[model samples]
Target: MAQHEDMQEIKKRRDAVLSALVDGVPYHRFLGIGFDRRGDELTGVLNFEQKLIGNPFLPAIHGGVTAAFLEVTSIITLSWNYLWQDMEAGAIDLGALEAGTLPRLPKTIDFTVDYLRSGRPRDAYARAEVIRSGRRYASVRVEAWQDHRDKLFAQATGHFLMPPPVTEAKAGKPG
Candidate 1:
Protein backbone atom coordinates (compact mmCIF):
# COMPACT_ATOMS: atom_id res chain seq x y z
CA MET A 1 0.00 0.00 0.00
CA ALA A 2 2.83 2.35 0.71
CA GLN A 3 4.40 1.53 -2.64
CA HIS A 4 1.13 2.28 -4.39
CA GLU A 5 0.90 5.62 -2.64
CA ASP A 6 4.44 6.45 -3.64
CA MET A 7 3.58 5.67 -7.23
CA GLN A 8 0.60 7.98 -7.00
CA GLU A 9 2.77 10.78 -5.73
CA ILE A 10 5.22 10.27 -8.57
CA LYS A 11 2.42 10.39 -11.11
CA LYS A 12 1.13 13.60 -9.61
CA ARG A 13 4.54 15.17 -9.80
CA ARG A 14 4.97 14.12 -13.40
CA ASP A 15 1.60 15.52 -14.32
CA ALA A 16 2.49 18.84 -12.75
CA VAL A 17 5.66 18.99 -14.81
CA LEU A 18 3.71 18.26 -17.93
CA SER A 19 1.29 21.01 -17.09
CA ALA A 20 4.12 23.46 -16.68
CA LEU A 21 5.48 22.38 -20.04
CA VAL A 22 2.21 23.07 -21.80
CA ASP A 23 0.83 25.99 -19.88
CA GLY A 24 3.96 27.78 -18.77
CA VAL A 25 5.59 28.16 -22.17
CA PRO A 26 3.73 30.33 -24.62
CA TYR A 27 5.90 29.44 -27.58
CA HIS A 28 5.34 25.75 -26.93
CA ARG A 29 1.62 26.35 -27.02
CA PHE A 30 1.92 28.57 -30.08
CA LEU A 31 3.69 25.80 -31.93
CA GLY A 32 1.02 23.31 -30.93
CA ILE A 33 3.47 20.89 -29.37
CA GLY A 34 2.44 18.25 -26.88
CA PHE A 35 4.36 15.50 -25.13
CA ASP A 36 3.88 11.84 -24.51
CA ARG A 37 5.62 10.89 -21.27
CA ARG A 38 6.30 7.42 -19.91
CA GLY A 39 8.34 7.25 -16.77
CA ASP A 40 11.38 9.42 -17.56
CA GLU A 41 10.88 9.21 -21.30
CA LEU A 42 9.35 12.10 -23.22
CA THR A 43 8.31 12.36 -26.87
CA GLY A 44 7.35 15.77 -28.29
CA VAL A 45 4.48 16.04 -30.71
CA LEU A 46 3.92 18.90 -33.14
CA ASN A 47 0.41 18.94 -34.52
CA PHE A 48 0.49 20.14 -38.08
CA GLU A 49 -0.97 23.42 -39.17
CA GLN A 50 -0.89 25.26 -42.48
CA LYS A 51 1.22 27.96 -40.92
CA LEU A 52 3.97 25.43 -40.29
CA ILE A 53 4.66 25.07 -43.98
CA GLY A 54 7.53 27.14 -45.22
CA ASN A 55 7.45 26.30 -48.90
CA PRO A 56 4.08 25.90 -50.41
CA PHE A 57 5.54 24.17 -53.44
CA LEU A 58 6.96 21.31 -51.43
CA PRO A 59 4.60 21.90 -48.52
CA ALA A 60 7.34 21.05 -46.11
CA ILE A 61 7.51 22.03 -42.47
CA HIS A 62 9.62 25.08 -41.75
CA GLY A 63 13.23 24.49 -40.81
CA GLY A 64 13.00 26.97 -37.96
CA VAL A 65 9.98 25.21 -36.59
CA THR A 66 11.76 21.88 -36.59
CA ALA A 67 14.72 23.32 -34.74
CA ALA A 68 12.49 24.96 -32.15
CA PHE A 69 10.68 21.67 -31.57
CA LEU A 70 13.93 19.82 -31.00
CA GLU A 71 15.26 22.53 -28.69
CA VAL A 72 12.09 22.63 -26.62
CA THR A 73 12.22 18.86 -26.27
CA SER A 74 15.76 19.00 -25.01
CA ILE A 75 15.11 21.76 -22.50
CA ILE A 76 11.97 20.18 -21.09
CA THR A 77 13.63 16.79 -20.80
CA LEU A 78 16.56 18.27 -18.92
CA SER A 79 14.31 20.31 -16.64
CA TRP A 80 12.28 17.24 -15.81
CA ASN A 81 15.38 15.28 -14.91
CA TYR A 82 16.58 18.06 -12.61
CA LEU A 83 13.23 18.49 -10.90
CA TRP A 84 12.81 14.75 -10.43
CA GLN A 85 15.94 14.70 -8.32
CA ASP A 86 14.60 17.46 -6.10
CA MET A 87 11.28 15.67 -5.78
CA GLU A 88 12.99 12.47 -4.71
CA ALA A 89 15.10 14.35 -2.19
CA GLY A 90 11.94 15.89 -0.72
CA ALA A 91 13.39 19.35 -1.30
CA ILE A 92 10.98 20.46 -3.98
CA ASP A 93 7.88 22.46 -3.28
CA LEU A 94 5.22 20.83 -5.42
CA GLY A 95 3.20 24.01 -5.44
CA ALA A 96 6.05 25.94 -7.01
CA LEU A 97 6.48 23.40 -9.76
CA GLU A 98 2.75 23.39 -10.28
CA ALA A 99 2.77 27.17 -10.61
CA GLY A 100 5.85 27.07 -12.84
CA THR A 101 7.21 29.85 -10.71
CA LEU A 102 10.61 28.38 -9.99
CA PRO A 103 11.74 28.83 -13.62
CA ARG A 104 14.02 25.86 -13.15
CA LEU A 105 14.70 25.27 -16.86
CA PRO A 106 18.31 25.04 -17.89
CA LYS A 107 19.73 27.72 -20.12
CA THR A 108 20.89 26.67 -23.55
CA ILE A 109 24.62 27.12 -24.02
CA ASP A 110 24.71 25.84 -27.57
CA PHE A 111 22.51 23.78 -29.84
CA THR A 112 23.23 22.23 -33.23
CA VAL A 113 20.61 20.80 -35.51
CA ASP A 114 21.17 18.46 -38.43
CA TYR A 115 18.47 18.27 -41.01
CA LEU A 116 18.33 14.74 -42.31
CA ARG A 117 15.34 15.28 -44.56
CA SER A 118 12.64 17.79 -45.35
CA GLY A 119 9.86 17.45 -42.85
CA ARG A 120 6.62 16.45 -44.44
CA PRO A 121 3.70 18.79 -43.88
CA ARG A 122 1.96 16.84 -41.19
CA ASP A 123 2.14 16.03 -37.56
CA ALA A 124 5.68 15.39 -36.35
CA TYR A 125 7.10 13.75 -33.25
CA ALA A 126 10.39 14.06 -31.40
CA ARG A 127 12.16 12.31 -28.54
CA ALA A 128 15.10 13.63 -26.52
CA GLU A 129 17.71 11.46 -24.86
CA VAL A 130 20.02 12.72 -22.18
CA ILE A 131 23.68 12.20 -22.95
CA ARG A 132 24.94 13.51 -19.65
CA SER A 133 23.57 15.50 -16.75
CA GLY A 134 25.89 16.84 -14.08
CA ARG A 135 25.62 19.39 -11.33
CA ARG A 136 25.91 22.45 -13.57
CA TYR A 137 25.65 21.22 -17.12
CA ALA A 138 23.68 18.80 -19.24
CA SER A 139 23.70 17.45 -22.78
CA VAL A 140 20.75 16.16 -24.75
CA ARG A 141 20.14 14.68 -28.18
CA VAL A 142 16.80 14.91 -29.89
CA GLU A 143 15.34 13.38 -33.05
CA ALA A 144 12.25 14.39 -34.97
CA TRP A 145 10.18 12.04 -37.10
CA GLN A 146 7.08 12.47 -39.15
CA ASP A 147 5.73 9.08 -40.08
CA HIS A 148 8.19 6.67 -38.51
CA ARG A 149 10.57 6.75 -35.60
CA ASP A 150 13.40 5.02 -37.43
CA LYS A 151 13.20 7.50 -40.27
CA LEU A 152 14.29 10.72 -38.68
CA PHE A 153 13.73 14.08 -40.35
CA ALA A 154 16.03 16.05 -38.09
CA GLN A 155 18.22 15.58 -35.04
CA ALA A 156 19.94 17.95 -32.67
CA THR A 157 22.33 17.97 -29.76
CA GLY A 158 22.28 20.67 -27.14
CA HIS A 159 24.34 21.73 -24.16
CA PHE A 160 22.75 23.59 -21.30
CA LEU A 161 23.80 25.30 -18.12
CA MET A 162 21.62 23.89 -15.39
CA PRO A 163 19.93 26.07 -12.85
CA PRO A 164 20.62 25.85 -9.16
CA PRO A 165 18.72 23.13 -7.41
CA VAL A 166 15.42 24.17 -5.93
CA THR A 167 15.44 24.14 -2.16
CA GLU A 168 12.62 24.96 0.20
CA ALA A 169 13.88 28.50 0.54
CA LYS A 170 14.11 29.01 -3.21
CA ALA A 171 10.58 27.74 -3.51
CA GLY A 172 9.34 30.26 -0.97
CA LYS A 173 8.60 27.57 1.58
CA PRO A 174 9.75 27.49 5.18
CA GLY A 175 13.03 25.72 5.31
Candidate 2:
Protein backbone atom coordinates (compact mmCIF):
# COMPACT_ATOMS: atom_id res chain seq x y z
CA MET A 1 0.00 0.00 0.00
CA ALA A 2 1.09 3.55 -0.63
CA GLN A 3 0.54 4.42 3.00
CA HIS A 4 2.85 1.65 4.16
CA GLU A 5 5.59 2.79 1.80
CA ASP A 6 5.19 6.32 3.04
CA MET A 7 5.59 5.14 6.63
CA GLN A 8 8.83 3.36 5.78
CA GLU A 9 10.15 6.45 4.06
CA ILE A 10 9.33 8.57 7.07
CA LYS A 11 11.18 6.21 9.37
CA LYS A 12 14.24 6.42 7.18
CA ARG A 13 14.12 10.18 7.23
CA ARG A 14 13.74 10.26 10.98
CA ASP A 15 16.76 8.01 11.47
CA ALA A 16 18.86 10.22 9.23
CA VAL A 17 17.98 13.32 11.21
CA LEU A 18 18.65 11.59 14.50
CA SER A 19 22.05 10.45 13.33
CA ALA A 20 23.04 13.95 12.30
CA LEU A 21 21.95 15.50 15.59
CA VAL A 22 23.46 12.92 17.92
CA ASP A 23 26.75 12.32 16.16
CA GLY A 24 28.83 14.93 17.99
CA VAL A 25 26.77 15.84 21.04
CA PRO A 26 29.02 15.41 24.08
CA TYR A 27 26.23 16.08 26.58
CA HIS A 28 23.91 13.66 24.88
CA ARG A 29 26.66 11.08 25.14
CA PHE A 30 26.88 11.75 28.87
CA LEU A 31 23.10 11.45 29.32
CA GLY A 32 22.39 8.75 26.73
CA ILE A 33 19.76 10.91 25.05
CA GLY A 34 19.51 8.93 21.81
CA PHE A 35 16.07 7.54 21.04
CA ASP A 36 14.10 4.92 19.14
CA ARG A 37 11.03 5.95 17.19
CA ARG A 38 7.81 3.98 17.09
CA GLY A 39 5.36 5.43 14.60
CA ASP A 40 4.84 9.04 15.70
CA GLU A 41 6.33 8.68 19.15
CA LEU A 42 9.92 8.94 20.40
CA THR A 43 11.34 7.26 23.50
CA GLY A 44 14.67 8.35 25.03
CA VAL A 45 16.72 7.05 27.95
CA LEU A 46 19.04 8.89 30.37
CA ASN A 47 21.42 7.47 32.93
CA PHE A 48 22.43 9.06 36.24
CA GLU A 49 25.95 7.86 36.80
CA GLN A 50 28.52 9.39 39.14
CA LYS A 51 29.16 12.10 36.58
CA LEU A 52 25.54 13.32 36.65
CA ILE A 53 25.13 13.21 40.39
CA GLY A 54 25.73 16.65 41.87
CA ASN A 55 25.11 16.40 45.61
CA PRO A 56 25.82 13.31 47.68
CA PHE A 57 23.29 14.26 50.32
CA LEU A 58 20.35 14.51 47.89
CA PRO A 59 21.81 12.16 45.24
CA ALA A 60 19.72 14.20 42.77
CA ILE A 61 20.24 14.82 39.11
CA HIS A 62 20.78 18.50 38.48
CA GLY A 63 17.58 20.33 37.54
CA GLY A 64 19.25 22.22 34.74
CA VAL A 65 20.54 19.03 33.13
CA THR A 66 17.14 17.40 33.29
CA ALA A 67 15.55 20.48 31.74
CA ALA A 68 18.13 20.51 28.98
CA PHE A 69 17.45 16.90 28.15
CA LEU A 70 13.72 17.45 28.01
CA GLU A 71 14.09 20.51 25.81
CA VAL A 72 16.50 18.85 23.38
CA THR A 73 14.47 15.66 23.06
CA SER A 74 11.23 17.54 22.44
CA ILE A 75 12.75 19.78 19.80
CA ILE A 76 14.44 16.90 17.96
CA THR A 77 11.32 14.74 17.91
CA LEU A 78 9.13 17.58 16.65
CA SER A 79 11.64 18.52 13.98
CA TRP A 80 11.72 14.93 12.74
CA ASN A 81 7.94 14.84 12.49
CA TYR A 82 7.94 18.07 10.52
CA LEU A 83 10.67 16.88 8.19
CA TRP A 84 8.96 13.55 7.63
CA GLN A 85 5.69 15.18 6.70
CA ASP A 86 7.40 17.64 4.36
CA MET A 87 9.26 14.85 2.57
CA GLU A 88 6.17 12.64 2.26
CA ALA A 89 4.20 15.50 0.80
CA GLY A 90 6.91 16.17 -1.80
CA ALA A 91 7.62 19.57 -0.33
CA ILE A 92 11.29 18.88 0.19
CA ASP A 93 14.07 16.31 -0.14
CA LEU A 94 15.24 16.62 3.44
CA GLY A 95 18.10 14.19 3.03
CA ALA A 96 19.37 15.92 -0.10
CA LEU A 97 19.63 19.32 1.56
CA GLU A 98 22.75 20.28 3.42
CA ALA A 99 22.53 19.81 7.15
CA GLY A 100 22.47 23.56 7.66
CA THR A 101 19.50 23.91 5.34
CA LEU A 102 17.20 22.01 7.66
CA PRO A 103 14.45 24.39 8.73
CA ARG A 104 12.70 24.65 12.08
CA LEU A 105 15.38 25.04 14.68
CA PRO A 106 12.71 25.49 17.28
CA LYS A 107 13.34 28.16 19.89
CA THR A 108 11.46 27.65 23.05
CA ILE A 109 8.96 30.49 23.27
CA ASP A 110 7.81 29.32 26.67
CA PHE A 111 8.21 26.31 28.88
CA THR A 112 6.81 25.10 32.19
CA VAL A 113 8.39 22.18 33.98
CA ASP A 114 6.93 20.54 37.06
CA TYR A 115 9.07 18.40 39.29
CA LEU A 116 6.89 15.51 40.32
CA ARG A 117 9.61 13.51 42.02
CA SER A 118 13.34 13.78 42.54
CA GLY A 119 15.43 11.73 40.12
CA ARG A 120 17.39 8.90 41.69
CA PRO A 121 20.93 7.99 40.78
CA ARG A 122 19.95 5.59 38.01
CA ASP A 123 18.69 5.35 34.48
CA ALA A 124 15.83 7.61 33.48
CA TYR A 125 13.32 7.38 30.66
CA ALA A 126 11.45 10.07 28.76
CA ARG A 127 8.56 10.09 26.29
CA ALA A 128 7.48 13.12 24.30
CA GLU A 129 4.02 13.75 22.96
CA VAL A 130 3.40 16.25 20.19
CA ILE A 131 0.26 17.98 21.28
CA ARG A 132 -0.11 20.25 18.25
CA SER A 133 1.88 20.97 15.13
CA GLY A 134 1.27 23.99 12.95
CA ARG A 135 2.87 25.72 10.03
CA ARG A 136 4.95 27.98 12.28
CA TYR A 137 4.90 26.44 15.76
CA ALA A 138 4.39 23.34 17.85
CA SER A 139 3.47 22.32 21.38
CA VAL A 140 4.97 19.33 23.13
CA ARG A 141 4.66 17.60 26.47
CA VAL A 142 7.44 15.42 27.90
CA GLU A 143 7.49 13.10 30.90
CA ALA A 144 10.64 11.73 32.52
CA TRP A 145 10.97 8.87 34.98
CA GLN A 146 13.72 7.08 36.82
CA ASP A 147 14.03 3.33 36.33
CA HIS A 148 11.59 1.33 38.47
CA ARG A 149 10.17 4.54 39.96
CA ASP A 150 6.43 4.98 40.41
CA LYS A 151 6.47 8.77 40.36
CA LEU A 152 7.67 10.86 37.45
CA PHE A 153 10.85 12.88 37.90
CA ALA A 154 9.59 15.78 35.81
CA GLN A 155 6.92 16.88 33.38
CA ALA A 156 7.31 19.73 30.93
CA THR A 157 5.31 21.53 28.26
CA GLY A 158 7.04 23.66 25.68
CA HIS A 159 5.94 26.13 23.03
CA PHE A 160 8.40 26.20 20.16
CA LEU A 161 8.78 28.69 17.33
CA MET A 162 9.61 27.21 13.96
CA PRO A 163 12.26 29.01 11.95
CA PRO A 164 11.49 30.20 8.47
CA PRO A 165 13.21 28.78 5.39
CA VAL A 166 16.82 29.78 4.97
CA THR A 167 17.48 32.34 2.26
CA GLU A 168 19.25 31.10 -0.86
CA ALA A 169 22.41 33.08 -0.06
CA LYS A 170 22.64 31.62 3.41
CA ALA A 171 22.06 28.20 1.89
CA GLY A 172 25.36 28.80 0.07
CA LYS A 173 26.19 28.75 -3.65
CA PRO A 174 24.38 26.00 -5.50
CA GLY A 175 26.57 23.05 -6.27
TM-score of each: 0.87, 0.74
Output the worst ten-in-a-row residue range by lDDT, candidate 1.
Answer: 166-175
List lDDT for all candidates, in order: 0.85, 0.73
**The 10-residue segment with the lowest total lDDT in model 2:** 95-104
Highest-lDDT candidate: 1
Q: Tell me the deviation in Å of residue 139 in model 2.
A: 1.8
Error of 2 at 94 (Å): 6.7
lDDT of 2 at 175: 52
Error of 1 at 31 (Å): 0.3
